[model samples]
Target: MTITSVIDPAIIQAYRETHFCVEGDAPLTLRIGEKNETLSALHKASGATSSAFVTAWNPYSRRCDDETNADLQKKLIDELTTRSLCFVNGVGRHPASDWAEPSLLVLRISLEAAKELGNRYEQNAIVWCGADAVPELVLLR
Candidate 1:
């Protein structure tokens, strides 16, 4: 079944077009609804069945200054640390847009927990992937 949301089509399209890049030693890029062999290998290596690419910037899609966005992102990273979750720093970047939001590729997060985090961060949606490694757009609102 297709998950539906109240978010605008244009915004959803923008989300789909974004390159969710996971940084560090094994930096990789993910796109919504697409499968990536690199991510699949990472998941296998890490023994992670699922992951979520999330950002705390521009809550509910509203523009925020760099400092504010960074502050919010720090909080998000803190939360993950508190939960002892393994994650790699990342960003959601749209090629056509200069704006890039700080993000994370949280490994082994359950769908429920990912949804909760998305809502908690006031994000319109998040990119989540299961064992198949196909990233899906999970709308929070």
Candidate 2:
């Protein structure tokens, strides 16, 4: 098993407009030796509409200015939802509403579906924004 840790409040704040100052560490586990098969299965499960795995980085962070942050946030959201499955590690739940955002809603629903499908990886906890920095999910990880 490989455990990857990524914490980037800058991108979190820039990419995610719903929630700024992300704080928390979500422990995720990727089972070893099945990455290829797992990805293929997920791709098939996603149907033809979904895009294959794609990697994008959002440079936007909460600390960024208004205009720049907005651009980055859009890019982040676009990248986050483009893939068949997103494996995010650090980042707390968006405030105001749990399913307020589309990406978040998709993530929540995907997590639930994965649970039903017996996905081995599950989010373990949610830490507040002030508690810790958030991590971005990347393919190279």
Candidate 3:
């Protein structure tokens, strides 16, 4: 399936307006793959210069318990950081009306790193490029 097919139109529009539309650059391509392989590929492709904004969805907010949710949230953040992704910012709940409970966690890393990370985690990897009119999703697996 194509990236357009899987992602919602509203999301594409929001991302375009907030990310791509404002930034004038090449449109990013989203690629999916297994964890280790994806990281390896990203490292090889980036050659040390390319960087991207990485975002992850934290669904624990929907759960009933605050403590458990907090723990999970910390775990997610720690894991991502451990992998070398730097924390960027967090979008408040419901940044996109169409999206559900999960709040978004944004991080910055190499564009190649984001592509590989997207493959490793579900609903967390997004590639934004300035060249495209909208965000495009590609699954490498």
Candidate 4:
């Protein structure tokens, strides 16, 4: 599916506002392929050092207090970490934000690894290739 079709416009807007011009002048290209094969190729191409920023939103929607929100965020982080796909970078929060339950979780990961992680949680997750001049929403099947 296209990024616009699957992602909430509010979330996209928040992202744009919070991360404006973050991608810099680095160029990026999206590639779709089997997960393992893609990872191997990426590793070979970048000497096992290529990595990108990735973000994932909370799967549930509930207006919780700050404590509850923190707990939920931790759970999401743990889930993602256990998969060895990425590590928590930080959270994206905005006043009256309507996307992601509380805030979106950020992590640094390789493009192929992000793709693999997105595939595992395709129903409620969107991953981005965030290391380029223009971050691309990765479509995982």
The alpha-carbon RMSD values of the candidates against the true structure, listed in the order shown, are 1.3, 14.1, 9.8, 8.7
Write the residue-wise lDDT of candidate 1 on 1-141 in tens digits: 876788888999899899999998888999988899999999999999999998899999999998998999999999999999999999889989896888999999999999999999899998999999999988888
- Best by the lDDT measure: 1
TM-score for all models, in order of appearance:
0.95, 0.23, 0.41, 0.41
- Note the Cα lDDT for every prediction shown: 0.92, 0.29, 0.39, 0.42
- Candidate 1, residue 70: CA error in Å? 1.1
Error of 2 at 92 (Å): 8.1
Locate the minimum summed-lDDT window of 10 residues in model 1.
Answer: 1-10
Better of 3 and 4 by lDDT: 4
Off by over 4 Å in 4: 1-8, 20-62, 85-88, 93-127, 130-134, 137-141
What is the Cα-based TM-score of model 1? 0.95
Per residue, candidate 2 scores C-alpha lDDT tens digits across 29-134 of 1222223333333334433222211111122111445565446445554645574544332232345455221122123223234332221112221111110112
Q: TM-score winner among the candidates?
A: 1
Ranking by lDDT: 1, 4, 3, 2
List candidate 2 stretches off by more than 4 Å: 1-62, 84-141
